[model samples]
Target: MNQQNVRNFSIIAHIDHGKSTLADKLILKTGALEQRVFKDQYLDNMDLERERGITIKAQTVRLPYRSQKGDAYTFNMIDTPGHVDFSYEVSRSLAACEGVLLLIDASQGIQAQTIANVNLAMAGNLTIIPVINKVDLPSADPDMVREQLEDILQIDSTEAILASAKQGIGVEEIMEAIVERIPPPEGDPDQPLKALLFDAWYDLYKGVMILVRVVDGHLKEGMTIQMMATGHTFEVEELGAFTPVPKRIDRLSAGEVGFVIAGIKKLDETKIGDTVTEFKNNCDKPLPGYKDVKPMVFSGLYPIDGDQYENLRDALKKLRLNDASFTYEPETSAALGFGFRCGFLGLLHMEIVRERLEREYNVDLLTTAPTVVFHLKPEHGDMVVIDNPSNLKKQDRTDTILEPYLRGTIIVPDEYVGVVMNLARDRRGIQLKMEYLTPKTVMLQYALPFSEIVFDFFDHLKSSTKGYASFDYEFLDFRASDLVKLDILFNGETVDALSMIVHRDKAYYRGRELVKKLKEQIPRQMFEVAIQASIGGKVIARESVKALRKNVLAKCYGGDITRKRKLLEKQKAGKKRMKQIGKVEIPQEAFLAVLRTDVK
Candidate 1:
């Protein structure tokens, strides 16, 4: 086979822009998998990926196709994560590819995330292949999309592929274009082995699977490869790319993208973006990759049933195998009981993980409101990272606490501009940049404290604009702001985990709303619970939920001794699940209600 004939590329797109579906069609058109073998996004092997309709991790597949000139060549198709949260993963994937198939949703034209991703791809110097996906949608305007790309992205749109991935239309042309347009890998195969670790994950059947792009190397079965990041080395037991169904053996040489499975047992050993070189003639210099990603959003995840804590831990570990962006630790909460101190790249990433944990792992959990880490400087000594509201204890000091802020951007119709400005002002948003996207559309930028947005601000933004506003935000480090530590008291005792820092002006409003939501979500319990939000010793907001008058061994259904004992056991279990929020042992739903606070 001619090595120069092969083309290695990845499909890049924003969320729900049909990147995965296009990969499925490419698999079908190339006859990579047997007829009917592929369902959708066959490259995304994780069940969570399928359920979420978003590619959470990067995956690669190999397909053999005949180009327009009637020549057979192999195309390595990599599907990358589409969200901003996994930008690190996406960048690493791009590093291994020579070209990218940029999928833009036709109706949406160009979005905030789409622009950001395209810029990253261009920065990587990959061959840009513009593709207008979902062309068959009623609202699709490919011409407008092309104009946007040409004008904003400064890329030629004459070669844009207008096709509907869901309908498998124009997919053959896409495969042919891959061979004709994208250049083949270039490197000296005889040189010391040097491959870029784009992504990695643990597989139960194959142990550790490391996906690499050979920059200047040749890898074969039985050869030893060293992971330079962690200084661990392993022998390559097998190497190949999936033909969308079964793994096929092929020598991975310079410029080609493929997977190498060494009998390694854990994901920790195969760090993403690490360099892999043959152990015998290992490359002297490590591969240059992006800086390690640090999660900005922090929250707590608790099992609905405390007994599932172990199961939750195992589920999280399994999830972390494929998701390097997630950071978590086991923690105990007075309000939420026992759960995890989870870290996320952003709010979207946090929501996606929570949804996946529920849908994929079948673990019902209660999550706290997402928060940005605050730098709390003690009066006497070092700075402490405060992620949990419960971790913010009342300490007597003249110390300074710096709160995280965010640079928020929103695009909305010009008609709702005033409403949006008013909303932002209420949330302590300081206007920054404003631009006109189109004659009727305007983009507004604001610098807002993270504390203000954590409490149903997104909902308020949407509701105020009647869902016409779309926004994105980036963390802007910590700054001194007018912040107050709002403590939640249940039964006159403070729940350390339930305390949070909020903007002084907005604290009372948020407190009242949160307690109200909690009152509605929390079930009646053994005793009345008073949910109080306080600053220092002053109560700012309060909500009182009536105690359960009808829960204690309500039914002794049978006279049988065994049946009566069973009823007692059930009652004990129920009582164990109830949490004392203030003076009330509230059910788990109330804790979750706080996370879904509806800003009125």
Candidate 2:
């Protein structure tokens, strides 16, 4: 393919912004996928993606189009996920494209990820073409959304493309915009090959397949290539682009996006953001903006059965092939036995990992409450990393505990501003800025601790705003806070899995509610089970599960008062002895049920 004829761009939008429908229309117009095999959500190959109607992984396809002006162009359209949890995916996708179609829903107007991704695309030097999608809906106000685009992104309303992607409206105009507005790739194919490994996934039969963008040179089969980051080398076994699915091609030249099979045996060999180049002809400098993904939330994943621990480990290895954002290590808890301490980008990322494990791998798992990384400095020693909250018990009171904070943004309707402000205040959010984009829409910015919103922030935000709010956030820094470890005790034994790091002011209230919830979950036993919330061996709150009792005097109903008293005394004495030896059998359900104990 001619380099001048190739146009590299990606579609960026918020979740449920009609991106998949738009892609289907363009692909149909360009004949990328055949009509017989075409189904809804064509690019969303995974079952979860199709079920959720969202794109989780980034996808690319090559389309051949002949414009009305009699010019043929090979358009490389990269599709990216629209969720904030996958914002990093958007950044990586932007790095591979020369331009982006910033799609906005004509009814929803500007959202959090819309602003975030626009800034990211601009930072990556990608051209932005504002697109107003879903214009055919009765509630779609194209003029209002166009004004939002202008007010927030400074986009010219006159240049905005209005179309309904579902009904194949303005597809020709979109194609024309690509040919006229977007720039072609610029590089020398004759030079040494340098490709960006934007994504990679393991194949059961073919080994690890890497998705790459040919930045400088050509990639062909049988070529020996080296990974710039890990210094691993292997010969290319297969090479091709997703002609929607993998179609074996002879070569992928400069500016083309495709996959390279280099006989990689393990998923770890191919790192996302690593540069792939020829072994003999190497590039001078590695690409800029190459950084490892930092997981913002941490949790524990233990199998329901002990034997499935190995299976859990293997499943994670397979899942991590494409998802380098999640990291895990072997960890053990006294209450849950053996498990892995896993790190994730956020709660949604963690939830998806758990769901995929149960559904795809058919392995049941026990997950702990999600937590963020904490920095604890002892009074006499160096700083310690606390990924799980259970480790906080060892810290001294004189030590400094620094908690992670984030710069958060929320865009919602003006009517819900008061509710949102109150929610933020309760979560320790400090208002940074508030602006009115339109008469009905308002945007709020706040600085909040990671621990505050990592669990239920999105859920509450949706409820308060009546599903009209969009939120996005990034790490700011770590600061010292008045934090303490709140421990949950069952039968006088501390359960490490249920321990939490809480602020001192809210400690007593949270402790009370937690113990009450635990009391409701634990089953009644022969011996009374006492559940307590404690700090440094001091009990702050307590709840009790009453023991099951049987009447010991029923057989002596006709006996005298002395006989009845003797029976009662003997039964009481036997109960005391049983309490010393009887053990409480806690089912796996009790541990998992604690997460659902929402006090409010």
Q: Compare the candidates by TM-score and give the number of the best one.
A: 2
What is the C-alpha lDDT profile of model 2 across 383-496, one tens digit per residue?
A: 999998887766565899999999999999999999999999988989999999999999999999888887677888898788999999988999999998888888788889
Where does the lowest 10-residue lDDT sum fall in candidate 2? 591-600
lDDT per residue as tens, model 1, 347-425: 7788888987887788998777677788888778899988876677774558677888788878788999999999888
Candidate 2 Cα errors over 4 Å, as ranges = 549-600
Cand. 2 Cα-lDDT:
0.87
TM-score of each predicted structure versus truth: 0.87, 0.94
What's the C-alpha lDDT at position 477 in model 2? 92
Q: Model 1, residue 551: displacement in angstroms?
A: 13
What is candidate 2's CA lDDT for residue 24? Answer: 88
